[model samples]
Target: MEYILLIILGFFAGTIGSLVGLGGGIIIVPALLFLSAGSSLFTGINPQVAVGTSLIVIIFTGLSSTLTYMKKKMTDYKSGLIFFIGSGPGSIIGAYVNKEFNLASFSLWFGIFMIFVSIVLFLKDKIKPLNQSSSGIARTYTDEKGQVHTYSFQPVIGILIAFAVGFFGGLFGIGGGSLMVPAMIIFFVFPPHVAVATSMLIIFLSSITSSVTHIIFGNINWLYALALIPGAWYGGKAGALLNMRLESKTVVNLLRLVLILVGARLIYQGLL
Candidate 1:
C-alpha cells in the first residue's frame, strides 16, 4: 500500500515537473513529507532525507523527459551546457551547506524559496521583454516543428542565474527547473519550449554532484527511490508529449498555478 502511494505520487510529480521544466524534486519532496506525516513506514522521516531521496529520483525523471525533448530538437545545447558548467560547482557547494545546516530551519526556508518561485513565475511575462533588449551572443535554433527561433542572450548573466539555481536546487532538494526555466525565459528571452527542454538537460547534469554529496551524507532512501522510478519514468514521457501539444502561454499559466499552490502548501507546512 505504501509502495502504491509512493508510485502514484511519483507519477504526478514527474508529469507536473516535466510539464513545467522542473526535475520533479519539488513535487516529490513535499509529497514525501506529507505522506510521512501520517504513515508509520515513513514516520519521523527526516526532511533532509526526503530532499535527498527526491534528488536521487529526479536523476531518472530528468533523463526520461530530456530524451523526449532531444528527439523533438527542443533543447538549446549551448545554453544548457553553459548552465550545466556553472551549476556543477554550485550544486556541490549547496549540498555541503545543506548537510551542515539544521534540518528544521532548512525545511522552513524551503517554503520561502517556493514563495519566491511563485512570484517569479507570475511575473515572467512582464519581465521577459525587459531583459530582451540587451544583446550578447546570437542563437538560431529549429524545433521539431521546423520553426526557427532566433534570439540572443548575455551568457555571463545566464551562467550566474544557473549558479544560483544550482545552489537553491541543492539546498531545497529541487531540480532548479522552477527557477531556471523562468529565468531563461524572462532574463534570456528563450522560447518557452527551448527553456523547458534546456532546463531539463541542465538539471540532469547539475544533480550529479548534489546527489553524490547527499549519498555521502547518508540522506537517501533507496526503497522509496526505487518505487518511485517506474512511475516517474512513465509520467515523464507523457509530459513530454503534452509539452509539444500545449501553447507556450498555456504552459506558463499552468506553471504559475502549480507554483502558487505548491508554495502555499510548503508555507503552511513550515508554519506547523
Candidate 2:
C-alpha cells in the first residue's frame, strides 16, 4: 500500500511537472514531507532527503519528457546546452547548501519562489527583455503549427539568470523550470513550446549535477526513489504528449493557474 501510494504520487508529479515544465519536485518534495508526517510506512524524511530524492526523480521525469519532445522536434538542445554553462555549477553549489534547510523554512522559501514565478507570469508582457535594443543572441523557430518565432537574449545575462535559476532549483530540488521557463518566454521571447521543451533539457542535466552532491551528503532515500522512478518515467511521457496537443497560450494560462495554487498550498503549509 505504501509503495502503491508512492507510485501514484510519482505519476501525478511527473505528469504535472512535464506538462508545464515544472520538473515535478514542486509536487514530490511536499508530498513526501506530508506523507512522512502521517502514521505510515513512508516516514522520517528530512528536507535534505526530500530534496535529494526529488532531484533524482526529476532526472527520469526530464529524460522521459525530453525524449518524447525530441521526436517531435520541440526541444532546443543547443540552447539548453548553452544555458547549462552556468546552471551546472550553480546546481552543485545549491545542492551543497541544501543541508541548511529545515522542513518549515524550506516550505516558506519555496513558496516565495512559487510566488515569484506567478508574479513574473503576470508581468511578463509588461516587462521588457533586457537590452531589448541589443540583439545579443538571436534565433528563429517555427512551431508544429507553422507559427514562426524569432527571439533573442543578451548572452551574459542569460547565463547569469540560468545560474540563479539553477541555484534555486538545486536548493528546492525543483529542476528550476518554474523560473527558467518564464524567463525564456518573457525575457528571451522564446515560443512557449520551445521554452517548455528546452527547460526540460536543462532540468535533466542540472538534476544529474545536483544529485551527485546529494549522494555525497547521504541525503537520498533509495527505497522511495526506487518506487517513484518507474511511475515518473511513464508520466513524463504522458505529459509531453498532452502538452503537444495543447495550444501555446492555453499551456501558459494553465501553468499560471497551477503555479498560483501550488504556491498558496506551500505558503499555507509553512504557516502551519
Candidate 3:
C-alpha cells in the first residue's frame, strides 16, 4: 500500500509537472515532506532527503518529457544547452546549501517561493513583449499549426536568470520550470510550447547536477525512489502528449492555481 501510494504520487507529480514543464520536483518534494509529517511510512523524513529524492525523480521525468517534446519538434535544444551552462553550477550550490535547512524553514521558504512563482505567472500575461527593443540573439519557431513566433534575449541576462532559477530548483527540488517557463515567456518572448519544451531539457540537465550533489550528501532514499520512478517515467510521457493538446492559456491558468494552493498549504504547515 505504501508503495502504491508512492507510485500514485509520482504519477500525479510527473503528469502535472510535464503538462506545465515543471519537471515534477515541486509536487514530489512537498508531498514527501507532508507524508513524512503525517504518516508512518515516511515518518522522520527530512528536507534534504526529500529534495534529493525528488531531484532524482526529476531526472527521469525530465528525460521522458524532453524526449517526447523533441520528437514533436517542440524542444529548443541549442537554447536549452546554453541555459544549462549557468543552471548546472547553480544547482550544485543550492544542493550544498540544502543540508543546512530544517523542515520548518524549508517549508516556509518553499511556500514563499511557490507563491512568488505564481505571481510571476500572473504577470506573464499582463506584460508586453520586450523582444522588440531587446538587442541579442533572435530566434524563430513555427508551431504545429504553422503559426510563426519570433523572439530575442541577451545571452548574458538569460544565463543570469537561469542560474537563479536553477539555484531555486536545487534548493527546493522543483526542477526550476515553475519559474523558468514563465520567465522565458515573459522575458525572452518564447512561445509557450517552445518555452515548456526547452524547460524540460533544461530540467533534465539541471536535475542531474543537483541530484549528484544530493547523492554525495547521502540525502536520497533509494528504496522510496524505486517505487516512484516507474510511475514518474510513464507519467512524463503522458503529460507531454497532453500538453500538445491543451491550449497554452489553459495550461498556465491550471499551473497558477496549483501553485497558489500548494504554496498556501506549505505556508500553513510551516507555521505549525
Candidate 4:
C-alpha cells in the first residue's frame, strides 16, 4: 500500500512537473508531508529519505523530458550548459549546508520563494519585455536562426541566478525547476513554452550533480527512493505531453496556487 501510494503520488507529481517544468519536487514535498501525517510507514528519517529518493527519481524524469524537448528543438543547450557549470558547485555547497543546518531555515526560505513565485505569476501580464529599454537590465542572445533574443539581463547575470537556484535545489531536494522557470520567463524574457522546456533541461543537469553529492555524503535512503521512481517516470511523460495541450498561463496559475497552499502549510508546520 505504501508503494502504491508512492507510485500514485509520483505519477501525479511527474505529470504536473513535466507540464510546468517543476521537476516534481514541488508536488512531491507536499504529498510526502500529507502522507506522513497519516502513515506510520513514513517516520524517523523518512522525510529526508523521501527527499533524497525524489532527487534520484528526478534524474530519470529530467532526462526523459529533456529528450522530448530536444526532439522538438525547444531546448537551449548553450545557456543550459552555462547554467549547469555554476549550479554544480552551488549544489555541493548547499548539500553540505543542509547536512549541517536546521531545516527550519530552509523551510522558511522555501515559503518565501514560493510566495515570490506566486506574486510573479499574478503579475505576469503587467511586466513588459525589456527590449530596447535602457533602464531595465536586459541581454540579447542570437539563436541558430539568427533571431536576436533579448532578455532583462546578460548571461553573466544568469549564471549568478542559476547558482542561487542550484543552492536552493540542494537545500530542498528539488531540481530547481520551480525557480528556474520563473527566472527564465521574467528575467530572460523566454516565452512560456520555451522556458518550460529549458527549465527541464536545466533541472536534469542540476539534479544529476546534486544527487551525486548526496550519494557521496551518504544521505540517501535507497529503498524509499526506489519506491517513488515508477510513478514519477509515467507521470513525467504524461506531463510533457500535457504541455502541448494546456495554455502556459493556466499551468503557471495552477502551480502558483499550489505553491501558495504549500507555503502556507509549511509555515503552519514550522510553527507547530
Candidate 5:
C-alpha cells in the first residue's frame, strides 16, 4: 500500500514537474515529508534525510524530462553545457552544506527560499519586455552553416544564475529548473520552450551530481526512489507532448499561480 501510494504521488509529481519544468522535487519533497511525518522514515533521521532522498529520486526525474526534451530537439546544447559547467561544482558544495546543517535550520531555510521564489514569480508578471531602444552587450554568432544566431545579453550572468540555482537545487533536492526557467526567459530573453528544454538539461546534469553525493553519503532510500521512476517517465513524455499544444503565456501564468500556492503551503507547513 505504501508503494502504491508512492506511485500515485510520483504520477502527480511528474505531471506537474513536466508541465512546469521543475525536477519534481518541488512536489515530491513535500509529499514525502507529509507522508513520513509519523512514519519510520521520520523517526531515525532528520529532515535532511528526506531532502537527500528526494534529491536522489530527482535523478530519475531529470533523466525522464531530459529524454523528452531531446526527442523534441528543444534543448540548446551549447547553453546547457555552459550552465552545467558552473552548476556541477556548485551542487557538490551545496550538498555538503546541507549535510552539515540541522533539520530545523534546513526546514526554516527551505521555507524562506520558497517564499523568496514566490515573490520572484509574482514580480516576473509585472516586468515589461525589452524594447528596441534598450542597449546591452548583445552578441551574434554564426555557425558553420553561416546562419547568424543573436543573443541580447552577456552569457556570464547566465552562468552566475545557474550556479545559484544549482546550489539551491542540491540543498532543496530540486532541479534548478524552477528558478532557471524564469531567469532564462526574463534575463536571457530565451523563448519559453527553449527555457524549459534548457532547464531540463541543466537539471539532468545537476541532479546526477547531487544524487551521487547523496548516495555516497548513504542518504538515499533506493526502494522508494525506484517506485517513482516509471510514473515520472510517463509523465515527462506526456508533458512534452502537451507543451506543444499550450500557449506559452498561458503556461507561464499557470506556473506562476502554482508557485505562489506551493510557496504559501510550504510557509503554512513550516508554521504548523
Candidate 6:
C-alpha cells in the first residue's frame, strides 16, 4: 500500500509537472514531507531529504515529459539549451547552500516563497508583457498545432533568470519549473506552450546536477525515490498530452491552485 501510494503520488506529480513545466517537485516535495510527518514508513524524513528525493524524482519526470513534448514539437531546444547552461552551476551551488540552513527555517521560507509565487501566477494574466520597443534576440518556433510563434528577449537576462531559478530549484527541490514558466512568460514573452516545454528541458538538466550533489551529501532516500519512478514516468506522458489540449489560461490557473495548496501546507507544517 505504501508503494502504491508513492506511485500514485508520482503519477499526480508527473502529470501536473509536465503540463505546466513546474516539474512536479512542488507536489513531490510536499507529499514526501507530509508522509514523513504522518507515516511510519517515512519516519526521519527531513526537508533536505525530501528535497533530495524530489530532485531525483524530477529526473524521471523531466525525461518522460521532455520526450512527449519533443514528439509534439513544442520544445524550444536551442533556448532550452541556453537555459540549461546557466542553470547547471547554479544548481550545484544551491545544493551546497541547502546544507547551510536550518531545515525548519528553510522549509518555512520556501513555503512563503511558494505562496508569493502563487499570487504571481494567479495574477499572471493581468501582468503586461515587456515593452516591445526594445527588440531582443529574434526567435521563432512552431507548436504541435502548426501555429508558429515569433518572440524575442535579451538572452543575457534569460540566462540570469535561469540561473536564479535553478538555484532555488536545487535549494527547494521544486525543479524551478514553477518559477521558470512565469519568468519566461512575463519577462521573455514566451508563449505558454513554449515555456512549458522548454521549462521541462531546463528542469531536466538542472535537477540532474542537483540530484548528484544530494547523492554525495547523502540526502536522498533511494527507497522512496525509486518508488515514485513508475508513476512519474507514465504520468509525465499523459500530462504533456493534456497540455497540448488545454488553454494557456487554464494551465496557469491549474498551477496557481497547486501552488496555493502545497505552499499553505508547507507553511503549516513548518510552524508545527
**Candidate 3 or 1, higher lDDT:** 3
TM-score of 3: 0.97
Q: Answer with 4 or 5, whichever has the higher lDDT.
A: 4
Q: How does candidate 1 fare on TM-score?
A: 0.93
State how far residue 270 of model 1 sits from its true place (Å). Answer: 0.7
lDDT by residue for model 5 (75-156), tens: 7778888888878887877777778765555555676777677677667658753422345455444433455645554456
Give one digit per residue, the lDDT tens place, for model 4 in 99-169. 65444554566667777877887786788643334664544545445577655545567788899888888
Return the clash pairs for model 2, or none.
Answer: none
**Candidate 6: tens digits of C-alpha lDDT, residues 123-242:** 767997662645566678766567887777777777888899999999999889989998888877788888999999999999999999999999998998899999999988999999
Q: Which stretches of candidate 5 lie over 4 Å from their true place?
A: 38-45, 125-152
In order of appearance, the predictions have TM-scores of 0.93, 0.97, 0.97, 0.86, 0.86, 0.94
Q: Mind sharing the TM-score for model 5?
A: 0.86
- Write one digit per residue (lDDT tens) for candidate 3, span 52-122: 99999999999999999989899988788888888989888999888999989999999999999899888
What C-alpha lDDT, on a 0 to 100 scale, does residue 141 get in candidate 2? 89
Candidate that beats the other on TM-score, 1 or 5, i.e. the better one: 1
- Score residue 61 of candidate 4 by CA lDDT: 79
What's the CA RMSD for each of the models?
1.9, 1.2, 1.2, 3.7, 4.3, 1.7
